[model samples]
Structures are given as structure tokens and as C-alpha cells.
Target: MNHQSVDVNTAQSFVPKVSVVIPIYNGEADLPDLLSCLLSQTYPKEQVEYLLVDNNSSDRTLSILQTTAENSPITIRPLSENNIQSSYAARNTGIKAATGEIIAFTDADCRPQPQWLNTLIQPFINPEVVIVAGEILALPGTSLLEKFADKQETLSQKHTLAHKFCPYGQTANLAIRQHIFTKSGLFRPYLTTGGDADICWRILKANLGKLEFADDAIVQHRHRVTIKELSSQWRRYGRSNRYLHELHGIELTREIKTKEYIYILLRWLLKEVPKISIQNIIGQASFADLFNTPLGLFTSRERSLGQKKAQLPENAKVIEWF
Candidate 1:
């Protein structure tokens, strides 16, 4: 690591070292783009270290990490977590190996904006703030499912932070003080889903610190491009909802009756469908976006109903959806 010289006459500036932890599982296709974004970050390279954790990947993910670390100007540590299949477990491994005071997290598929790290770390300048949740938006997509996901703001942190029990940020774009982990304990290594919520709530419960949102700290994520992929994503969310309810007493959305389901479907088709038009969708949407935006809600709800009758697994293999 290189250090910049500072004049002793004036007080030196405070720049907290940041460790970016990303957990990956067969992310070969998306790794290049994500790495490019990381390498192009506007943040001081000397102050940031990236820990890319591979969670039992069966692809060329390990090879890519090795190649990047060899040629990259920034510090890149390629680590592995094969003992547990969960992404949270992989993250815990990265956390243990991280050397920075403030640890930031993004997925292997997420593309951070150039100013992401610089803006994300700014909140920690205040003593009261311990967690920083950055904004997540979808990368532009060509498929109907992808456009629908983008229109719905599927990756937004707003809804997650608005949880009734406690506000929490998804791991896609979040930063936390390293000391908070020691006080709150690391994330439940076995949790395949809802681990972000679990950890943030634990920190708040322990009175360790508070969380903040950074609007300018942005990361773009690729949305699922097919119906099967979209459905799988919602199913995971449903299972997460069930797990969270069991752990934190968070209430699940009541199941709709047969009559109510019919009513909603009819209402959406009869009343809402006609309201959409080229005028409203000109610059903002495509034909896919115009039709799928309203229809996706029903599909998402039905897909998420997996939690209603789902059995929680003891140690489920974490699937990388991004």
C-alpha cells in the first residue's frame, strides 16, 4: 500500500480504510464487468482493499480472481469459503480476513458507480453513524422480465430500510464499521436469506450504533432476464420472509382468498390495462415495460407464496441470482 505525504503544519485529513467484501458463486459472466467498475472507482485506491470470497464455485471464478489480483493496481484478496454453502458464511470468511476499519459490501455481479466508495465512506465521518446503506438500481436490460424488474425498482434499498421491526440494508450496497461486528457478532453463517436484516437488527438491538442512507452512493445490478429466474428470486424472498418471521416476529403478508385473487387479477386486466399507453411509456418504457409492470406484481406475489408452504432447509446451497 502506498501512502501520500502530508504537511505537518496543517492537520492531516481523515480517510478511513475501507474493505469491500463480495461473495461469489459461479459468477464468471458478471465478474469482468463488476471488476472493471471496481477498478475504475474514484475512491483512493491506497485506502481501499477488496476481498472477493468464492463460495464453492464450480466455474472459472477462482481463475478470474487470480488473474485480476496478479495484474490489478489495487489490492485484491481472493479468498474461499467451502465449509458452508451460504453467501453469508462466505461474507463472514471475508470479514475475518479484511484489514480495513470500515467494511463495505457489494455482490460479484454489481457494478458500482465511480463515486460509490467515496460517497459511501463519507457518512462514517460522523461518530453517530455506523452503518451506511447505498442506493441500488437495476442496470438497463433488453428483456421483458429485466425491464419489469428495473421498472419495479427490484433492488431498491428503500423498502428494506422501511422494515417495521428495524431498517436494514441489503448486502448489495452496504457499509458498516468493523467494530460493530465484534459487538453485534457476525451474521448467522447458516442463513441463506435474510442475513442482512438479521445482522442489522442485531446491531441495533445491541445499541451498538445507528444506520444511515447515502443516496449518491450507487451500485447497478443486473435484474433477472427470464420468468423462471424472476420467479426463483421471489421464492427466495418468500422463504426469507418466513425465516425473518420466525426469528424476529416480522409479520408476513396475509394470503389472499380465492375470490380476492380473482378480483385483483380482473381489476388489473380490466381497469389497469387500458390505462397504459404509448403516451405514458414513450421515453420511459417499452411495450414489455408497459404490460409487464402491472402483471409482475401478481407473479411476484404468487412466486413468493413458497414461504407459505415451504420447509426451511438446514443448510441450503446459496444460489447466485445476480
Candidate 2:
């Protein structure tokens, strides 16, 4: 409950008014840099309200949050019960408690640029835009696996930015109107992964408003350095995808297909496994990214078919994805 307000007189005046919500889960190592980036924003301290929602972290995350709150103007709220295990639930908690009209979200592991907040909120000047998704750059690491993962992420971001039909948004760098969540409900609590995509899908389905991509709104995503960490992360991502498909009525999309899945398996057998094995590498690693195309396609198709089959009868209670 430690609350301290920053003196704004000494800071810049052109602070674009916005509230930044960062959901923390065992992010003790990443907090200092993340908070330093926030405190260094071009935006004025008084115009911004920082919210840190601790998602029942077992580490020193809460202690860091408390320490940060005492010195900064950030509001730190510890969840009463960690009943909701997902980060999406933690974000929803922050969304419910946020006071600013323009709500910005980022991961505790992200370090945003100085102009990140300013640029993210710039698109809001046009009344037609409701959501603004920022660019996420991966932080530098020495590991080859880290580079590969980052490259994949960069390519995905570029693809999303290039396509008008792509409405996918990441929690790492996304902002939305406060009222959207208030009137439409927040993110789905059940989704442990892809909750950002699920939330964006719901927003688009409801025709809530237009979504814009902000290239200037940059946040550096700190990726895991080892193959073991990456494999576990991807597996969790896959499980989350399954949960999202089951909980939401939406499908993955047509780009992912069955043949692609086969190609992935073949590639792993022919290329990746041989390379790793020849090097005497023995770890739980993945060449999953090589198969993501087909996997995504198959998952999307399965989800679509499932949704079609699950269609409820008239007068039945409609399940809310959020």
C-alpha cells in the first residue's frame, strides 16, 4: 500500500496523458530495467499513472514492486487470491483498476523506448482508432537459439504490420480504450496463452473500433537465452493455443495446414535433430518453429471446425470469451 507521487514541476510538460499497466509474474530480474524505462519516458509523470499488478508471483517480484512503488508514482496492487493463474487475468485486474482513459499494456520483461508511451498514444488523436499495437524488438543475447527466436518474432511482427487483415496484437506492446474493457468485459481468464490474440479477436468481432500499428512505439522483449528455456516456452505457447481455441469460438486461420505439419516433422528428422545430435547437444530443445506454419494451420482449422460444431441453439446463454 505504499503510495508516493512524483513532483512534476521539474519534468517535461508535453507528457501525453495515458496509463501504463504492467502485469508482473516472477519478474524480479526484469523489474529494475523496466521501471527505469518507464521513469525515463518523454511523457510527464503527472499525466501518466503506472499500474503494477502482481500475479501471485512466488519470487521477489512483490518486494521489487513494493520498493518501486515507494519511490515512483506507480500504484501496486497485490491480488487477494492468485485464483486466476494466467497473466491475462492479472492484466484484467489492472484494467478494472485503471483510472486513465487510454490504457497501455506491456510485459514486465519489456524495456520500452523513451518515446514509447508518447508514440503509442499518438494514434488516439484520431477518434476512429480504438487500439494501437506497438513494435516489440527482442533484446540481444549471445545464444543462437535466442537469435532464431528473435528473428521469428521480428518476422511475425513485420507480417502483422504489412497485412491489413491481420488483427493480432501482443500483450508486450498494446494499448486500448479503457471503456472497451469496461463495457465489453476484460480478457478471458481461461486462456493461459495467446490471450492477446483472443482479446483482439473479440474486439474485432464486436466491431469495437479500428486497430492501428505504431512502429514508433517500441518495446524490447527480453527473450530466454537457452534452448531448454525456449522449448518449454513454446510448449506452453502450444498448450495455451489449445486452451484459447477451446474457450473462444474463433479459429486460427487458413495459413496453417496439414501438409505443413508433416513438413515440420520431416525437417526436424532430417535437419535440426541431426545438427544438434552431431554437436553432442543433449537438451529438451525444439525445432517447432520450423513446423509452426502447418501446426498453426491445423490448429486454426481444428478450432474453426470445433467452433462450428459447438454452435449453441437459440435462447441458450451465449458464452462470453472475455
Candidate 3:
């Protein structure tokens, strides 16, 4: 869909300085693509800066950043957050170094459209909008897992924005005003996941500002290509659920029952098995991946159920939102 551009005349002088912050850990393989996207961004380079924070990667991620800093036309700042291993910590480091009025975040494996930043920040023309989230679409891939991700729209902002209690956005395509951090506080540095939701909720709960969704601001995310990688992704999600529940008293979904497991198995055998053709039998198709979805969900729920309840973080308050 074509982007619906905001009328600059409707708002009081719209343009604002923007900082694009990305957290990287052993992202050497993905850096080239991400950098290419950033360089191609249609946003005014004079009004923007890129902060690429390295979370102490063991690979050549830092070296690549150093090279880009010297050669790139756009301003690139390479910072490090070695103390903590979490992505959120790396992001916080970038946040501290950002000088732009707006802080936009995207992952190392994500490729934003040329107009991503320009479109993302348009909603901020209204003074009340503190958070703006963009759409996340899966990049095309040949693997079954990747195909499944695309089919489900796994990383789309719609899921989180439809949260039962309060909406949030993934960091992959979110932009926030710099001052919001000062008021709502930065993300929990220790969280390996779910920090985005936590910080967004805190901002909303404090009534700091409004959150807006910008469908035109699109970012394409790379999906896990293998079953192992996909399983790990879901497992982290399960762990995140536990952390969120502990912090907010959010209700958790019960463990998958044995009956449901049997049903899934039956469906796989009766439905999915019939879809298998010559392309599938020769390992040239993704038809078989459909069966793995149920298994993934089952494992995720089991992981969530088995996870030990964690203690609340220091100075954290439990807010019961039903």
C-alpha cells in the first residue's frame, strides 16, 4: 500500500532530528544488508545520526562498524556495552549517546524501507505522540521455517498492539521521543527479551504520551531458517512471558493439555500428511513445516510452565491491569 503522507502544514513545523539506534551482537553476517538499508534511507542525512552499539561481539562486527564510520556519508557512531550481554543493555548504551530529538530503533537483521524513518517520524509531528511503531514483515526466504514466519506474520506490530491490557511495539520498528526515556526510565538492562513491552507499558501507565502506529513505516525482518533457530526463538518468547508475569502480575496461559497434544498429532497425521507431495518428499518444499507449528507451540507452553517464578526486579511495582 502507498504511504499516506502527513500534511506538514497541519502540524507546527514538522521536521525533527532523528537518531537511528541498532544493537548488534555477532551480527557481522547481517551488517552489510542493514548498513545498505540505512545508507539508502530517504530521511534527511543532515537531520539524522546512526548509533550502532556492539554488545561485545566475538566476531568482526565492531571492525565493520569502524570501517563504515570512516567511509559512510552518513554519521555512524560505534559504541560498546560489554558489561551486560543483553540486547536491551546495548540499546541503552546507544540511547545514552543519541543526540537527536527522536530515537528510532531497528535490529541488525532488519532492513527498513527507504522511507521508513521519514514515515515513522511523521506521526510525531503531533506533540502528543511519544511512541510510533512501524510494520514488520518477514523477508522472503526459501526455508520452511522462514516461510512459516511469513505466513503467520510473526513479527507484525498488530499482535502486540492488540495486547489485552496495554499495547506495545517491538523495538525492530519503533521510534520514541528522547525525553520519554527521562520520564518513564530506560528499558530494564538485564532483560534479554520483552524489554520493549515493559518500557512501552511503563510509559503508557505513567501517562507520559500517546503511542501511534505507522503502517507505512515498514521494516523487513529476517526469520529463523532452521527448526532449531525457530525453536529457540519461541523458547525465548516463553521465558519472556514468565518475566512479564512476574513484573506485572499478568495471567499466564496454562500448560498444553494431553488431549490438545493428541489432537495436534491427529491433525498432523490426517491433514498435513495429505499435503505432502513429490516436492515435499524430495525435501524441496515447505509443506511439511506446517506440522512443526503445533510442536513449537507445545514446547513453548511447556517451557513457560516449567520456568521457575522469578522475583520482581529492584524497585519494580506490580500493576494489575485486567
Candidate 4:
């Protein structure tokens, strides 16, 4: 998907300056590789800059960013947003500090491909595209939980177009025009999760600009390998659902019901059965997918806890693992 290159700033050009913002709490293990990748990006350094905001990390995340800032090709603005314990809050801080018309957001744990920024910013060439959803694939890990995490992300991003109003945009690989913030508003700082959907929904409902999917613009996310980590991740998602629904005036009695268990099992069976390479029933079946159905029960339970917090005036609970 090589789009014709647009000048960084031309009177009638769509290519405008871009600011890539990455929000992290404790990302020492992941930040270096991501920063190195950014330095290798094909996007014009003169037209692009980066903002790595720390949410008061008590780890080496700050030192690493300071070091990376000293060596990165483009200007790297290191900022802080510690008052709120939400990545969305950190992102808003970066948004305020950004000088580019195009603001791209990626997680600190993600290792973006070299062409990532170049590809992501391409759709902006249309001028009408205000929000772009780039592709996210999981970096391989040994654990089945890691594999499950990968599978879940693929499903989550792919099926978003079916959503009636706001097509989903994960911060792992999302780019938005700066003006969208002026019109659609910034990420809800109160939200610890799903603020991406909340803002994109706001934009769509307002008919601000085109929301396009850029499949070639990709990011590789580090999947949660342990059960505890995966459960915590889904719980935030569960809680965010409540917040989003409330904000939209949509109400649901149950987040997960008994009937859903059956549906999930059937859905997994249908999707996995056809691709089996074995003739024997055991060989044809995937135990991991089978286990994922029941795991959904645990994750949904976590979601229930989040929905419970949504009832509180201030949903400030933070998932430490995130």
C-alpha cells in the first residue's frame, strides 16, 4: 500500500506534521526496542516528532526515555502525567504538548514496523480521514495465554467495522488528526480503558471526518503470557464497557449470561473445526480454544468488577499489571 508521498507541508497537500505519542507506566523492558524502531521509521524526521509520556513510573522507564530522547533521530519530548493513573490521561498530556497536526498513538510495549508511521500517516493524504486504525499482531510467545491474547486482538480489531457507530481503534496502532481533538474532544481522562472507543464514537456520531482502516500500517504487541495478567487486561475492558455504555445512554442488564457460554463454545468450535489437519476427533480439536471458552467466564467476571466501579462517581481503580 504505497501511497503517493505528500509533501510535509504544501499549500494543497495532505501530509502534515505528525506527533507520535506513547504512554507508559513501567515500560523499561519494552521502551528501548520501540524507541529504536521509531528511530528507524521511514517517515520524514523533520516532519515528525515523538512524545513519550510517563505516568509516574517507579521503575527505569523514565531513565530509558531520557536516554532514548538523547539519541533518537527526531525530537523526542518526554513529559509526565502522574495525577491520574490512566494512560488516556498521559496521552492527553502528550496531545497538549504535540505540535503536529497528525497525532499517532502506540503503546510502549509495541514494536512498530519500520514503515509503520509512514504507512499510518498515508491515509491522511485523503484529508478526509480523521482517524486511522492500523493493524496489530501479537509478538510470538511460548504460553497458550499469549496465543489466546493474539487471537483475541485479531478478533477485536477485525470485527469493529460491524459496530454501528464507532469502529474500534486500539491505541496500540491508532492515528488521528489533531483537529479531531478540537471537534471530537480528547481521550476521556477518567477512563482507564476503552477511551479509544469513547472518543472515536464521539467523532463518528458528530460526523467529524472519515474513520479509515489501514491494514498495512502494523504494530506488533507483546501479549500477556500469564493467566493473572490476561484476566486483569479483560477486567479493565469489562469495566470500560460500563463506562462507555453509561456515557452513550445504552443500558444492559448483564455483561455475560449463561446462554453466552453455549454461544462462545459453539462459535469457537465452528471456527476451529474446519481447519483441523487431523482426521481423528482428538487431533482435529484444539484444547486451547476449548479452554478459551471457559476462560471467558473468568474474564467476564473481572469485567463485572469493572462495571461495579462504573457505578462509583470516580472510577479511579487502576490495574497494576497494565
Candidate 5:
């Protein structure tokens, strides 16, 4: 509730208010570190505000945020969104509650770089650019699933940009002018995943905002460490993504076949098996990454299959994946 409205005439320093919003659900364990990183940000304390929305957490997350805010140097506002059980819903709540001109978003598990906020809000200086897409890199990982997730994410972002996807950015590291919400609307509350891309596409397609990429504005994301975790997460993403494509009139050109998947697995094994150094691992790759080709292939297939199933009315519900 303690939000400072900074006006050029009111304050001599006159720093533009930048509100950083984060949505959390059962994030008690990670909130401390994320908060610590946020507190350490190089952004000006008087100009920055942290707005965190809790999605009916079942643990000590609320208390942790409240206690931290009490002693923190920066302005921290912690709110609760109990009506819905989705991050998008929490983000919407945060957006409505935000007092800053610029709203930056990240997750409870993500660690933003020191200059993340400064870099993200830079594009807004030009009135034409309303949305900024920051970089989401994987936190350093040694496990196979983690490394695979990171690699997949890197390729996916590159592919999205290369294909000229507009308003593209993950909420894990993104910023937008607050007025853009009133123009483009909030993220779909029903979607448990892919909401980030969904809103971005909507804003860009409607020509409501100009999206820019801020490569220097970065966040280190912790990818799922285990195969089961990765599977469930990607499956949810696939399902939500299918809903998104359908909503936007995007069509899949072809269906993946069992033989095609088998072929892909074979090709990977034949082409990748020889590149392993030491005990068959490429530079910086662990032994797990070298042997996880089959699992990675299977994961992709499951994600694809989930998307197909989600196209059906009977399988469109957003089931909790974690």
C-alpha cells in the first residue's frame, strides 16, 4: 500500500517509477532468493517498486514476503489473488494494482540481472515502443533434464525471433508500459501456461503496441531438473499453446507419426553419439546430457501429443502439472 508516485515537478530527482511485478504460488522456498536478488538490483530504490501477487499459496510465502518488505530498502508491495489459481490471474491482479508507469514482470523462481529493470524500461523512453521483451536464459545446470530444457529454450527463443514472431517474450523477463494493459487487455486467466505468448501476440496483432527486444535485460530461470517434472511442465505448455493457436486461427500443417518420431530418434543417435568427448560428451556437456537423447526425444513427442489432445473439447482443461 506504500506506493510513491514520482512526478518530475514533485520530486527533484524525478526518476520514472518502474514497478516490478511477480506472481508466486507455493514459492516459499524460492521467494527469499528471488527477493534478495530484487533488492540487490541496481535500479534506483525510490523509483522502483516490487509488487508480488500470491496465488493462494499453501505455505509461508506470504509471511516471508511481508517480513522481507518490512526491512527491505526498496518499496515492496505484496498482494493476494484468491479468486483464481493461475499465474496469469495473479499477474492481472498485480497489473491492476500497480502504481508505476512501467510494469516489469518476472517469476518467483527467476533471478533477474542487476540491470534488468534499467535495461527493460529503456525502450519505453521512446513513446512508440510499449512492450519490451527481455532475455530468459537458463540458470547453470549440471543435470540432463536441466541442460536439455535450457538448450530447448535457447533454440525456441531464437526460432521465435527468426520466424518474425511479434511481441514475443516470456513473463520471466518482460516489461511494458502500464497503459498497454488497458489497451491490449490482461492475460487470459484460464490459461495456466502460454499466457505470456498469448498476450504478446494479442497486443502485437491488434497494433496496440510496438514490441522491442532487450537482450541486455536478462533473467536466469531454473528449468525443471527431473524428467517427470520436465514432462509435466512441457505437456502443460503444449496444451495451453494448442489452445492459443486455435484461438488465433493458427493451424498445424501436419500430424507427427510414430514412424517419424522413431526416425528422429534414430537420426539423433546416429548423428549425436559420435560428438561426445571424454566419455562421449561435447564441450561443457555432462555425461547425463550425452545419454539423454532418447528421453529428450520422448519429451518432445509427449508435448506434441498433448497439443493434439488439447485441441479436443474433452481434453482442454488446464490440469495442474507440478
Candidate 6:
């Protein structure tokens, strides 16, 4: 669907300089830190409008939001019904209500640096640029697992930057023109996972324009601890990949084929099992280095393909694969 272009000058005149939309789930514990960081931004308060969308979180998240709004200069909007619970849905809600020409996005668990907003909006000086993605730094933690997750996230960012075709945005630290959402028809609601990637895919397909990587727009993310948490995260990512496949005619890469995935998993077990059993060995090699990363890529392709396939009805005479 084609998006109606808003007159840049007129929109800018009516709206604030930038509208920062944060979608909150059950994240009461992290609200204070996130708000503190936002309040301390070096950017002028009058130039930026902070909008918080609460996704009907059942915890103290709403109460905290209300209290924080009283002390801070942020606007808090609570959803009437929790019908749509995902972050993507929540963000879409925020976009519809935002008044800024430049719509900035960040997660509730992320704390942006003082220069974050300034850096994120700088690229928008060029009207052609529609999307701006920034760097995500993991906060220091005592747990080794947490530190490992941080390192992995950093590596992922670097890899994402290295790829030109795969240039994407993370909600944790991203900004885009308000018209993009208005024109692009928001994110894919059915995709419970990899919604960020799905949105990026659509943006690129629309030929909306270039996506800029602003390294100076930095935000600190809190890493999840424990292997169980990591595994669950990755699995959900896999399922999301399936959704993507259903929407777009794409599948997993050759590296992420089922056989290769299992092979790498077994290889990691064989290599690390003995080391883990040793008396003095504390750190065993992890298979994530081999399978998980590639698996994610494969899963993304598969999800894209699956999504496309499902969209076609029976006897539709869709193009057949060789």
C-alpha cells in the first residue's frame, strides 16, 4: 500500500521536533532507569515529545507510568483493551497517536545516552533518509551468562552493520520518518516474532529510501540471564521466522538447513562434553558460535517464505519452485 506523504515543512511546523515513542509491557522494574535516562537527555525538552504506550500491563507498570508522568515531561497513553499485546502492535498504536514528523522508537528496558536523540535525528536532516538505526550497548552484569549475551548482541550489531542488503532496525534504538508508518501500514500484526525484521523488509521493498546507521545514537540494553532464557528467546525467534516465511516468499539459507543445524548441534556437544566433565574446566565451548547465529538467519529466511506461501490460496497457480 502506498503511503500518503505529509508535507515535511508543514508537519514540522505543527509537530514537535521529534516524538520518541516507547512501548511498555510488564516492565515496571526497568521504568525508573529508562525514564531517568530520558529525562537527562542533552536535547532540549521542548524539541522532543516523549510518548509512552502502556500495553495493558497487569503489574505496577501503569502506576509507575502515571507517577513518572507527573514528575517528568513525558505523555503517557494507556491502551483501553489488551487485545493486541505484542510490542509491534503497541508501537503501531503509538505511531498513530504521535504528532512529530520524526518518530523515534526504543524499548522500555533500554536506556538511551544523553546524545542518543540528537544523534538519531541528525540523519533526518536529509529528507531522503527514512530510517535511522543506532548502536545498542549491553549494561555490565555480574553473571557470566549475562556478559556472554551482551557480547553476542554486540557481535550481532557488528554483523548487521557489515551487511548492506540486510540493513535493518532494532526497536531498542531506532528512528524513522512518521510518514513511513502512515504509508507502510504499520507492522505485520500476525508476526509475533521478528516483527522488527519484517518491518525493515517491507520498508526496503517499498523503496521508501535509505536507512542510516547512527553509531552515536547509543542505548544500553539489559541482557537476560540463564541459558534457559537464552534458549527460549532463540526458539521464539525461530517461530517468528516461520511467520516471516509465511508472509514473504523466503526460506532458511543453505547454512541453516535442518541437517546442518543438527550437525552443528551435535558437533558442539561432542567437543564440549568432555571438557565440561573435566575436574578443573570451568568454561566449556558453546555451540551457539556455530549453529545459533546461522540458525537465526536460516529461520528468518524460512519465516519469510512461509508467510508468502500461506498468503496464497489453494489452486491459485502460484509460481512453482524448481
| Per-residue lDDT of candidate 2, residues 231-253 (tens digit) | 45655555444455555644433
Kindly list the per-residue Cα lDDT of model 3 for residues 146-209, writing each as its tens digit.
6667777778999999888789999999999998888877878877777889989989999998
lDDT of 6 by residue, 7-66 (tens): 666534443378888888888888889888988887667777777888879888877777
lDDT of each: 0.82, 0.67, 0.82, 0.75, 0.75, 0.66
Steric clash count of candidate 1: 0
Q: Each model's TM-score?
A: 0.89, 0.72, 0.87, 0.82, 0.85, 0.74
The TM-score, computed over Cα atoms with residue i paired to residue i, of candidate 1 is 0.89
Ranking by TM-score: 1, 3, 5, 4, 6, 2
Off by over 4 Å in 1: 1-12, 277-286, 289-294, 313-322
**What's the lDDT for residue 242 in model 5?**
82
RMSD of each: 5.6, 8.6, 4.5, 5.2, 6.2, 8.0
Clashes of each: 0, 4, 0, 0, 4, 20
Superposed model 6: Cα runs more than 4 Å off: 1-16, 74-81, 154-156, 161-165, 253-322
lDDT, model 3: 0.82
Q: Which window of ten consecutive residues has the lowest lDDT sum in model 2?
A: 312-321
Q: Name the candidate, 3 or 6, with the larger lDDT value.
A: 3
Q: Is candidate 3 or candidate 6 better by TM-score?
A: 3
Better of 3 and 4 by TM-score: 3
lDDT of 6 at 292: 41
Task: Name the best candidate (by TM-score).
Answer: 1
lDDT of predicted model 5: 0.75
